[model samples]
Target: MLDLTKLSQQMQGMSQHINREAEASRKRIEIALNLMEQAKLNSDNLMQKHEEFKQRIIFKPATPLEPLNHYPYIVEPPLAHTVFATDGSQIAPSAHEIAYCYLINVGRVILHYGQSRHPILDSVPEIYYRPEDLYLSRQWGIKTEEWMGYRRSVSEAIILAESGQQLLEISPNQQLNIPTLALVDGSLVYWFLEQLPSEARDLILQPILQSWEQLRLANIPLMGYVSASRSSESLSFLRLQACTFEEPNCLKYCPGTGGMSATGTEKKAPCQVCDPLRDTVLWESQLKPGQRSPFWRSNSSILDLYDHHQIYFCYVNVGMEIARLEVPAWVVENSEQLELALGMVIAQVQKGYGYPVVLAEAHNQAVVKGGDRSRFFAMLEQQMIKAGLRNVGISYKEARKRGSIA
Candidate 1:
């Protein structure tokens, strides 16, 4: 339950905080504006900033491609094209069940756009009840869900990769000239891997990497599109370049400069000078319809493990939302593939009213409704009963809710 009054008060405080720091944030933006144009040509400046932080920086926001610029390059997708999108919905482990169980539903959508629109949609639900799947620790001491949700995420990526392969076989008679784009619904680099144990990460990330390899080997273009993204990796780079601090990683030692308070009386916290704007918000004014920002490589520490699969991103305004799109290094290096992917994504967004039609369809197919969850558990209960198992009833609290209504 939420305390409405307290939450309301916090919102007021947040507004005041923004007001207090507005001027300083504006100044920081001005400083960043000066560097934005020269960010690429003056690589020495960024390099010096990077050298200052050295090993202290957790994630480095270096651009392996071109630097920040406002040049809007709109790539019109091929007149006849096919787009494939995959998304996943999961049922987390619940305590009201007889057995420790979970379920993952992966939804896939393949759409042919141009003269005639033909859409193929499918969903596959995977159920897990094995001891290994339910527990993480050696002695079954800790539940897998307790640690993190990486298992489901990894599974989703693997399934998404498989779906991409299936898209290739969709129509053997189709012309080879028609561009095909494979898309997933998140960042290409799995940051959650860093949270898991080293051994667990190795075991899980392997399949995801293999999926990327599969797509690459088959000459399929893949992308990860995040709509209205809150990621600030690009802003972090701006901070590094805009900071007045001569030393590397001043955020570590300088507690005096974080986020601003509602009142200007207190010292600001670290990284507050950047004004806390996400990369998307920062670029909303810069990009026009169908134009995408320059590629920014993700500096996440987890990205180092990707080897050849490191991720790069660009912001695209598809006449609706400023979306962040991520792709592997291979995709970025290939000029033709990048242009086709960007064009197809923009086209999809326009067709779906600010979102990709295929992705939205995949999401619809993947979603698990509340009634569906209830029925699933009910089915499990019946199976338990039929197997002559006792003590398989739900918790008393759940039972009371089932019997009571507001």
Candidate 2:
């Protein structure tokens, strides 16, 4: 039944591709290593130069990013604190299924270290079949699975914020003062919403802003943790510092060729002085266990949509791996809150072997396994039959497989 020879051939081809990619990546990393060595020698000069480029980029909006300083420090968390984490998973609408429906399951976990004897856990499942939820506006011009995924992610984040808000208000008999750190599994900024029309985007933002306000009022620090992040925001800044041409000079010295003769025109400057590598690559070796880099604010246009909740981020070494942590402007402004959050994140990662334990549990709780998904559809079909509704049978191919497998 299996083509072992063909499978072996395919594996050999994939191995070749992996080797090629590895070589290319090595070359790219070498470029970054050279720039970093240069940065150490001229740190003060680069710092002042970065400010000049940042100012000049405002007037000339076409060019890319600004470099920021990388300052690393270690933070020791308080002995007693509570970590509330929430994660979500979803089953998308399928055509072969009888009903046009989608399900989102959110898992929330509360872990109180040095304050409580046991962890608390909960889960909420939401099923959507409303007309508005099933379809998108015609003007949006897309009905792809990616759009549904984005909607699900936004819903998950809102629910997590709400759960965090509720937890902050809880009053227990063991009334010792303990710091609370609320965490979500992804970025705080809804970057995907930038593609939608202003009106549609505003509608989605309304509930998220309300949820954020609840957490803000409760004074709980919320963080979005991304492991093995590929974001190059910091690298983009480094490129600006490494580039030979100043922002203002790009107009004259780096003007396009426009088919002009080389004899009369100024030579085009080299566009990129350093290879495009992720910010983590530079910090992977630099950040020690429990240490974190300084904050770097994103200049993404999507950030403008979030007036007060704009995002700022940093990288931390959690004893096992490097991770990116994103926080809102509110967290960045409060020094005590920021320090507490950083410490807790590091502590959680150390406890969980490079990942947060609460988040891992939340994910396990939320995940919809293959067996569970099959059972869900079977149950739905049975309900439809009981209600005297005609069932749209599953695809013949699926039916055949199900009949033969068992």
Candidate 3:
């Protein structure tokens, strides 16, 4: 009787284990089936697009079209040597509305432009947008950070950064000088410019390249301000490699990206292999010129005498690379500098525009779209107004730095 009791307990345990195993196996199969279905759907979509393209070619196949691009002509050296930064931004599903703007500075006056224009704002559905709910988001800006969908993050980040640049261009009066340095909020490399449609891409490159031609002829100085948005974010990525992941390829620390090339007025497509970081500072490089070592990982890009200060965008042109670097940590402390710059810009804008604060709203209004943008807009507005600014409105959408996009 005792042996029979022990055998009965063993049998019950075995049966429970088998049942659990079967359930686990069933789940795996379900997952596999779902993935297969998704793959099939993607394949079908590609086929349909291919067929459509084929039809266009069959009917419209004609001559090879050569692109004719013209650069603007400027006769004289800009009144005051200046800097102009042009930028563009895009949302996930709403590719139709890529934000394009420019910032101009003749080494004195800050030219800011901000307008919400929808270019190539497509109502296309992304694979991730739930089919049932996609109709609600068709025309609305679609964005969400996904690990597997990292490019979405990149695309949106670039879009927000671009809007900030455009905010600089939308001067109420719209008159700017040449020989300006454009302090773009991102990298100096236009490799990613090609990611945009041809016309959309030109909206960004045309002005700067035109200025480049004019400046080159006039022998003037006009570079861009390209810097990382937040220093902490940059630090997080660095620490991930330095303390967390210990990623390889870390070489000597450099102040700027070495060996920059002069991109012509004709914009080209973005190179896939190009590094995603800002072009202002060579994050991973040795200080020596012509060394050509691998990328570096450190906060030594442009540390001020005290330390790396980010609030004030630092302009460092080492060899061919001209970059604008911001130390977010530093920006938090010395906000007065940012306020001073905005104050100067607002004053300049008001000199020509009707009102100061009202003019600033065109760009500032759009900053708050979905939720509480009051704290943010108020802070920026207060900063500008406190600086005795001229009152040129700003699009809050364009002003929110990286990671601030909704």
Which candidate has the top score in lDDT? 1
Query: What TM-score does candidate 3 get on C-alpha atoms?
Result: 0.22
Candidate 1 global lDDT:
0.75
User: How far does residue 189 in candidate 3 sit from its true spot (Å)?
Assistant: 2.3
Query: Candidate 3 lDDT, tens digit per residue, 239-353?
Result: 1112111222112221122334475333211211122233223222323321121111222222222122112223222234432333233222433433333333223233435
Sort order, TM-score high to low: 1, 2, 3
Residues 1-406, candidate 2: write the lDDT tens digits.
Answer: 8999988977877978989878877786777767666765665665566556654442111112123244557587888888887787888887766777888888888888886557878778887777677776445765635556666666766776776655655663342257788888877767678788887787677777777777787788889999888777766655544667644345555565233465875433353433445778777867777667768677777777788987888888876777889988899899889998998888888788879998998898888999978887788889888888874568777678768965
**How should the candidates be ordered by lDDT, best one leading?**
1, 2, 3
| lDDT for position 175 in model 2 | 23
Per-residue error for 232 in candidate 1, Å, reads 2.3
Q: List runs of model 2 lying over 4 Å from the truth.
A: 1-4, 10-27, 37-70, 172-176, 248-271, 404-406
- Go through the candidates in order and give each one's C-alpha lDDT: 0.75, 0.72, 0.31
Q: lDDT of candidate 2?
A: 0.72
Measured with C-alpha atoms, the lDDT of residue 23 in candidate 1 is 70
